[model samples]
Target: MDFHHVSVLLQESVEALNIKPDGIYADGTLGGGGHSYRICERLGNNGKLIGIDQDSNAIAAAAQRLKEYESKVIFVNDNFANIKSILDKVEMNAIDGAIMDLGVSSHQLDEGQRGFSYQHDAPLDMRMDRRNTLTAKSIVNEYSEEEIRKIIFEYGEEKWAKRIANFIVQHRQTAPIETTGELVEIIKRAVPAGARRDGPHPAKRTFQAIRIAVNDELGILETAIRDFVDVLKVGGRLAIITFHSLEDRIVKQTYNSLSSGCECPPQFPICICNKKPIVKLVNRKPRLPSEQELEENPRARSSKLRVLEKL
Candidate 1:
């Protein structure tokens, strides 16, 4: 399958980076090199851009799309959570800016074999990097009812998590939940007929929850955000685009905490905690897609872009 992904918030994210002619930048989730391509356009020959993605397919496709700028680009096939180590290996200490688009690419969802979409009846495999051992099948078949319930509720924010988890556990006991279709049917049975009549697909949230758990999406994001910021030069910017509320909340809270000048209470007579603000929020509220972009691509609706500048 062709690795294709419409970069979410394309123009906005690139502009937010405020690229300089000779500055160094990183695209932490270099899917199809959409944003990275634009960043390259704004760079002079001396400028450098590092692209990283866990999926080998993304690296290959991005290499093709960004071939013209090969002289100024470096591609790494690794998780963004290892940004610090990757940067060190490349002999770089700090970067002028970095951008992370935290959405499963269109290729992942469209490619039925990946099993990221509920509409597809493929094997229960949702590993972003095929190298990973744990998959959606393991998550569904091995996880306890309570564990599954918490994943659905906390990650997917599905109100019917308990019922859904219980249903999955009960059905998997008879036979392993081997495919997306089987899981979708279990989800349908879990949701009430009335509730199932409207809204998104019954299996959407459950599938998302399982995929997140299989890939450790949230855990990596939390760690990557801090590490990304830590490598930013003074006045360097970090822009992140999250597709889900849970991901957005983590980004927002992390940025806020880092931007906070001090942790001491207002009543404190003297400074106890010597923590100083590392970055300032570039935008008080996350930048959302415009009505025009939404019309062009419905998937862009959930995207929230948050930026911070290093102090």
Candidate 2:
């Protein structure tokens, strides 16, 4: 399958960066170079763009897609969580701006063999980085029922997680759960028919939860925010587009933590911690895609763009 991903919140995210013609920038998620390409377009020959992705497929596609500006583009096959080291290797102490769009690409979901979609009847493998040993197969067949339940409930926000976990455990005991189809069947059985009839595909939440757990999507997020803040030059912007509530929450909290100054209690008259706000939230609220953008790309509906500028 071609590594294709429609960049969500395209214009909003790039504009939030406030691009400088000669400035250095980073696309931490670099999905098909959508945002990076636009950033490059606004840059002069002196500008630089660092693109990073854990998936080799994404790396190759982005490299090819943005080859026109190869002179200013640097690609890396690595997780965005390691942005600090990525920037370090390039000898970059600071960047003018950065962007992170935390959404699974369309290609990943469309490719049945990748096993990211519940609709696809493929092996239970949802490793964003194929090099990783852990997969959805092991999470389904090996993890304890309680653990699975926790993941689904916490990560997926699925109310039927307990029942789904129970069903998976029972079925796997007879035979190891080996495929996405098998898992979907179990989820369907676990959820009540009436409830399943109401909203979404019966297996969507479980699949999302399993994929997130397999990849540790929520892990390293807060640290990444701090790292981005550290590398951003004063007035440099950090724009993030998150697809789901969990990702949005983390970004919001991290931005607030970094932008909020003074750790001292309200009653205290004198300053103690000596903390100062490092960044300012560009907007009090996240920016949503325009109605036209959502109409053009339905996948963009859930996207919310949040920006922060270094103090």
Candidate 3:
């Protein structure tokens, strides 16, 4: 299958970055190089772009797409959470802007074999890197019922988390949940008929929860935000596009906490902790995709772009 993904909030995110013709930029989740291509187009000969992705497919497709601008582009196969170390290895002290588009890419879902979508009946393998030891199969079949419930509730925001976890644990005991179809059946059994009909697939949230746990998506996002902000030069920007509320919340909270000047007590007359704001939010609210973009690609519907500029 072709490694294809329509970059979410493409123009909006690049605009949020406020790219400079001669400055350095990084696309930490360079999916199919959609946004990265646009960034490279706006750059001068002196400008540089570092595209990083853990998925080998993304790296290959992006490399081919960006070959014309090869002199100005560098590609790496790694997770965005290692942005700081990546920049250091590339001899970049600080970048002018960075972008992170979090969530499973459209390619991962549409490919069918990657097992990111419950709509697909492939093997239960949702490892983003394909190199990771942990797989959705292990997460679904081996995790304790309580742990499964926690993941579904916290990561997936599924109201039927406990029931779903219980069902999974009960069913998997008969045999290991080895395929997406098997898990989907379990989820269908757990959710009420009316509830399942009203919304998305009954297994959607559970699949999301399992994939996230397998990849440590949320944990990586939390760790990456601080490092990404630290690597930004004064006045540099970090624009993140998140596809789910949990991911959006992390980006929003991280931006807010960094932009907040100090955490000192209200009663304190003089400053003591001396914590300073690192970045200022470009917009108080996240930028959502326009109606036009949504019409063109339904996957862009849940995306929210948040931007922060280094202080």
Candidate 4:
């Protein structure tokens, strides 16, 4: 399938990066090259862009989309968690800015074979990187009920996690849960009818939780945020767009920690715990999509963009 993803907060994110004509930048989530293409447009010949994504399909789509700027673009087929190593291999000491959009691209959800969305029926596979051994199927068929419940509750924040996990455990005993359709049916049965009648689809949370567990999405974020900041040069900006509260909370807390000047206890007037601020918030709060953008692309509705600059 042709990889297609509508970039969320396109203009806002690029402008936040504050692209310099001859500065280096990185698009850590490089889905469909939407953000990367915009960065490339703002760059001079001396400027370069390192676009990285774990999805091979994303990389391929980005490469083709950015073919016009091939000379200035370098693509990497690895997770952005290793931003330091990625930059090191290219002999880049530091970058002027970076952008990370934490939402799964539309293509991933739309392509049924990838099995990211509960809307479609396919194999229970949600590995962002096809190379990974652990998949949604493995987690569904293999994990203990307690373990499954924990992931759904903690990761998905689904109030019906207990019932859902119990249902999954019960179903798998009869036969291995092998497809998204089968899993969706189980989720429908687990969530109460009144609850299922309202809000988003009943299967949304469970699928999200399973996908997160399979890919370790939340697990790698905090450290990656700090690491990305470490390699940023003075005045460098890191703009992250998160689709849900979980990642937004992580980014908010991490950025606040780095930007906070002191960690001294309230009573300590002696000025101990002399932690200095490393970065400043580019925006006091996260940026949301405009009314027009939301109408044009409903998927952009939940996205929250947070930008921080190295001091």
TM-score of each: 0.98, 0.98, 0.97, 0.99
- Predicted candidate 1 versus true structure: per-residue lDDT over 1-311, tens digit per residue: 47888888999999999899999999999999999999999999899999999988899999999999999999999999999999998999999999999968988899898899998899999998999999999988998999999999988889999999999999987889899999999999999999999998888898888888988999888778999999999999999999999999999999999999778999999889999999999999999999999998899989999999999
Question: Considering every candidate listed, which one attains the maximal TM-score?
Answer: 4
Candidate 4 structure quality by residue, lDDT tens digits, 173-234: 99999999999999999999999889999988888888889989999999999999999999
**How many residue pairs of model 1 clash at the backbone?**
0
lDDT of 3 by residue, 170-224 (tens): 9987888888988889899999998988988888888888888999999878779
* TM-score of model 4 vs. true structure: 0.99
lDDT of each: 0.93, 0.91, 0.91, 0.93
Residue pair clashes in candidate 1: none
RMSD of every candidate to native, in Å, equals 1.0, 1.0, 1.1, 0.8
Please give the distance, in angstroms, between residue 258's alpha carbon in candidate 3 and its true position after superposition.
Answer: 0.7
Considering only N, C-alpha and C atoms within 3 Å, which residue pairs clash in candidate 4?
Answer: none
Worst 10 residues of 3 by lDDT: 1-10
